[model samples]
Target: MEFDLKKSLEILDKTPTVLEAMLQGLSDEWIFNNEGDETWSPYDVIGHLIHGEKTDWIPRLEIILAQQGGSKFDPFDRFAQFKNSEGKTLHQLLEEFKILRKHNLEIVRNKKLTNLQYTLKGMHPSLEEVTLAQLLATWVVHDLNHIAQVARVMAKQYKHEVGPWFEYLGILK
Candidate 1:
């Protein structure tokens, strides 16, 4: 499907609320539970999302608008959250994500970009040429991807407990 700014913004705007409803009031045990060494807890996922808020979406948008062909996007540090979220509580991380998202949305709304700007091209380190629309679309999907991941990771916590039910639950698989 083609990008629609209004619908995208609606999704963007609700992410924090969606997350809060899913996670709020949960204990640290629930929030930090992961299946194994290779997985991330909900806490870690929030931190990663926060890291993207600060470094990825809007910065890439600006680069695309200001210097379309001049510079490629810097490689994103996916694990920065491990260092950055040190000593922070899940509550604090959630608040930060909400605040940063609000600020980023304000900037995007203010720009009132035209369709031409959305069609404008930018260089990506790995993807080569990409349009602003693609970047924006990724922003929406990224939120969804992580939300699904949070669910998957949490669901795995009960993998063994579910027994025969696990066979029916594709999420646990």
Candidate 2:
């Protein structure tokens, strides 16, 4: 499907509320439990989202908008949440996500982007050139991906408990 900025915003704007409703006030077990190894919990996912808001999406968009061509974006540190989220509570992280997402959406709207702007290209640190449409689409899908990640992590906590029923749960897979 074509990337429609307005439709993108409709989903993007709901992410925080969806996350908050799904996660807020949940116990530490739900907020902090990972799927073993290097996986992330719901809390960690939120922190990672916050990191992207501060470092990834808008910043890359600005580079593309400003450069008008071949703008090299600073590489994003995907693991920054480990240190940056230190001492932060899940509630605090959720609040931060809401505020940052709001501000970023406002910035996106302020641009008043058109089809030409959507076609504008920027140099990704690794992926070579990408269009604004691609970037914006990623921004929307990234939120969804992590939201699913959070759910999958939480669901796996009951992997063994669900026993025979586990086969029916695609999320645990």
Candidate 3:
């Protein structure tokens, strides 16, 4: 299937809005909660997602547009990258994410990327090849997956009492 830029943008737009709402009214302490472990605080996850947006997602999009074929790509190590990053606050990371996301959306929206066919290869762990259309679909799916993860983390870290609501509905437990 070909990459549907319009559909992807729509999904991207909605995902961020929901994320912002989910994060609303959260104190910096809550946003930066390290309850999950030493590796991933809520802030770290946002940083990882923002890094993925800029370094992983956008580069892949570029490769797709350039139709760069048969070259090995490096999959992003989101956790490691964010861990080493120097940002001290979630707000800064979120602002960066917002900027990158907006720029990516603009690129997708303004470009004539329909019917484009390209192949991308990755070799960080092992060699793999994917088409432009497949990559775009993956990007959308990836966004949804991370958004759900953020919701799950938020529910666990901050909404313990209310989490049972989702648990009863089978969304979580």
Candidate 4:
């Protein structure tokens, strides 16, 4: 479906509560388990989202909205959560995500952005150039991708026990 700001906000605003309801106070087996090395645990996914809230989505949008030519965006640190998440518990991360998402959404609503504004451009570190709409769309999908990652990672914790049914359980695969 095409990006609608209202639709995007619906998903964005709900992400934190969804995550918390799914993960809050769960055992380490559910919250911290992963498929393997280099994969993110559910906890790690929350940390990564927090990092993006602080650095990625809105900051880049501001540059595009604030400039005519659009300034280059800072490269997003994909692995910052590994270090940044140290010492934080699942609850802290969830709360932070909720606050940041709420604040970002407020800013977006206040902008009263026009169709022309969504077309405003920004320089991406890797992609080179992009539009505000694409960035907003990415913001929504990025939340979803990570949410799926969390589910897949958690489901795989029982991958071995659900023997013979693995084929039917697409999530394990």
Question: Each model's TM-score, in the order given?
Answer: 0.96, 0.97, 0.77, 0.97
Answer with 2 or 4, whichever has the higher lDDT: 2
Instruction: Quote the RMSD, in angstroms, for model 3.
Output: 3.4
lDDT, candidate 2, 28-104, per-residue tens: 99899998888888888898999999999999999999985569999999889999999999989999999999999
Residue-level lDDT of model 4, residues 1-173, one tens digit each, is 97689999999989999999999989988998888888899999999999999999889989999885558999999999989989988999899889998998998999998899999899998999899999999999999999899999998998999989999999987
Per-residue lDDT, model 2, residue 145, is 93
Each candidate's lDDT (Cα)?
0.91, 0.93, 0.65, 0.91
The C-alpha RMSD in Å for every predicted model, in order, reads 1.1, 1.0, 3.4, 1.1
Candidate numbers, best TM-score first, in rank order: 2, 4, 1, 3
| Better-scoring candidate (lDDT), 1 or 2 | 2
Candidates 3 and 4, the one with greater TM-score? 4
The list of candidate 4 runs beyond 4 A from truth reads: 68-70
Against the true structure, whose lDDT is highest?
Answer: 2
Off by over 4 Å in 3: 1-3, 118-127, 158-169
Tens digits of per-residue lDDT for model 1, 1-173: 68999899999999998888889899877899987987789999999999999999999999999973575788899999999999999889999999999999999999999999999878888889899999999999999999999999888888899988988999998
Which runs of model 1 end up more than 4 angstroms from their true locations?
A: none
Q: Top TM-score: which candidate number?
A: 2
Candidate 1 TM-score over all chains jointly: 0.96
Task: Give the Cα error of residue 59 in candidate 4, in Å.
Answer: 0.5
- Cα deviation at 123, candidate 3, in Å, is 7.1
Model 2 misplaced regions, further than 4 Å: none
